[model samples]
Target: MGPRFFGYRDRVQDELVREGHQVECVDDRPSETVWFKSLAKISYHFTDRIILHYAEDLAERIAKEDYNMVLYLGGMSFCFTHRQFSLIRKSSNARFVAYLWDAFVNCKRFGQCRDLFDDIYSFEVKDCERYDLKLRPLFYSNTYRSIPLGSEGYFDYDACFIGSVHQYTKFKTVSSIVKELEAQGYRVFKYYFMPSRVAELWCKLTHRCYRGQVFQYESLNTTQVVEVYTRSKAVIDSPQNGQNGLTMRTLETLGARRKLITANEDVMHYDFAQYGDVLVWNSDSDGISGFMRSPYECPPESVLDSYSIKTFVQTLLGEAPPYRGYHNDDCCNETEDAS
Candidate 1:
């Protein structure tokens, strides 16, 4: 019924609530089922609503609540806005936690929120290096060796993507990636758009710049999305930061026991990758092409042998390794050497 979009905010809110933690989502837009049903379904298991444009009002609201913490999603301006943070600090009584997508690029925008956050969660290791500055490496939970949990070592799905591309770089990057996959004879379908309800209108207006495959693409529901990802042979599960988490697709895909090809090598290195040979790595530009020709298969028993969902949750909530200062000395030494 309102401006709906399926992004990480819903996932974040849903997770917090599932943990029985009270959560207040602050955003300028509303959740329209026509636009964000898949998002709500995948991320939230219960009823949900927007704050009717709680841009800065959330600050005062938080100040009055009895919450345990405040989680700041990546703001609407693309990076964390100073206004949002200021209001959060002004509004809440709980510990301030900032969840950012990219640690490298989006950092400069957190002039106030940076100091206000009690913990920071970044999907990037570069952010881990500065955890004392409020970085929480919670994304490094355990990796699994199996898929479809109950199903033996079999996945019916093929290749898939969970996150989306909206801006200039994102559009270019995602469209190019999909085109690249297509060039290699892979079938790719993406459902992410600006906002679900107004997606058509916005696309029509911005088509001159945000040109990609809109007409050819139609949205899919959450169940269908997870079904496809789990059934596929491989899922494109890495994040570009500012586009973080183990990636909802990563967890859901692995939970489904499908092979994963992701950019989140840091987590893989943290002991999750050992679960199976199903994981595909593509760090360099050319590596992606190689994977296109020879996609990796999802490993079954290995994922179970490596990590579990409980452990994954602990990591997300800051109960695992990758805590601040783990590799600080080495990083500092390396930096000094270069200088």
Candidate 2:
């Protein structure tokens, strides 16, 4: 797994260890200095050189080890070149597998490295059909499952939103929703996180929507996110533009047994949404007040279990069948789901 900003890599590794597997965790990008990470977002030349060097080092190390499988999680395009992938493939006899929690649009380089894997999976339905990949949704860690649901009238806030503000559109949409929720007399908790001060300054200079906006620089850990969800009756989700897959937050909300207020209309087609566990909000925040006033309906226990990290790992390792419910053909015309 790549070292993600939210520490999901470590969480996935820990889950593997819990499953009784002797695992070797590799950081695809070990140079995690602030400047190096920031440059990776803007400079393809610099990023490519770093990845190339890392691949050579990794290939040499992999040649010395004997493993049954090489489970790669995300970052195929951003972290590896075709030649680099070939080098690693030549070094190890392990079955190479990849699981892309991100969409193809976000990882444009995925096509170049797609054929190198023995088995590949994606969270987005569109990507699965387009690339002939298996369909799988992102999973919620066990932390969310352990959260005790609050009794009626026990919530500290009516709703909560905790996510990064990556673009101006998401910032504007979230800000408007929060304002509307407050106007309706619902207590709301918001944590709009920006990656760094550098990003904040760049947005301030370029996007008028970000000027004077209050953004938290530090990201909330999984425990903190669970705490916020515990205190809130419902959680808000605004996906990035053109992304059509259920996000980690969406599954986490389900695991926490909380109501979800999302911008993704495609969510209505999911099994969990059939029970009224999710609300698809529009630009004007229509039906939000009534939705928030309604009681949250829990999906079936089987549906919830299918989305746990344990199930996800099992499916990735070919130990269990992939969860099947909604087909991508049913929602081909739909705009997008949450990211």
Predicted model with the maximum TM-score: 2
Candidate 1 all-Cα RMSD: 8.7
The residue-by-residue lDDT of candidate 1 on 1-339, one tens digit each, is 011244456655555567676666655333444445455444422222332234345555666678766555552322224554455566756666555554545445554346666665554455544443334333211222333443334443246665554444445555555556667666665555454535645765765546435532445566666566655566665465355335555655555555566655454543345645334444234655454445355455544323344443344556554332223234554322221
- Prediction 1 TM-score vs. true: 0.58
Off by over 4 Å in 2: 47-50, 328-339
Instruction: For each of the candidates, give the backbone clash count.
Output: 30, 0
What stretches of model 1 exceed 4 Å from their correct place? Answer: 1-7, 28-56, 75-84, 90-92, 130-158, 161-218, 237-246, 263-268, 276-339
Global lDDT of each candidate: 0.49, 0.80
Error of 2 at 91 (Å): 0.9
Best by lDDT: 2
lDDT of 2 by residue, 1-339 (tens): 466655666777888899999888887674778788777777545777777778888889889989888887875335666886688888899899888877876775656877878988788788876767777788898989898877678999999999999687777778888888999899999998998888899989998888867889888887789999999999988777777688788889999999998887777767888887688878776788778878777788899998899998888898977667554455443313211
Compute each candidate's TM-score over C-alphas: 0.58, 0.91
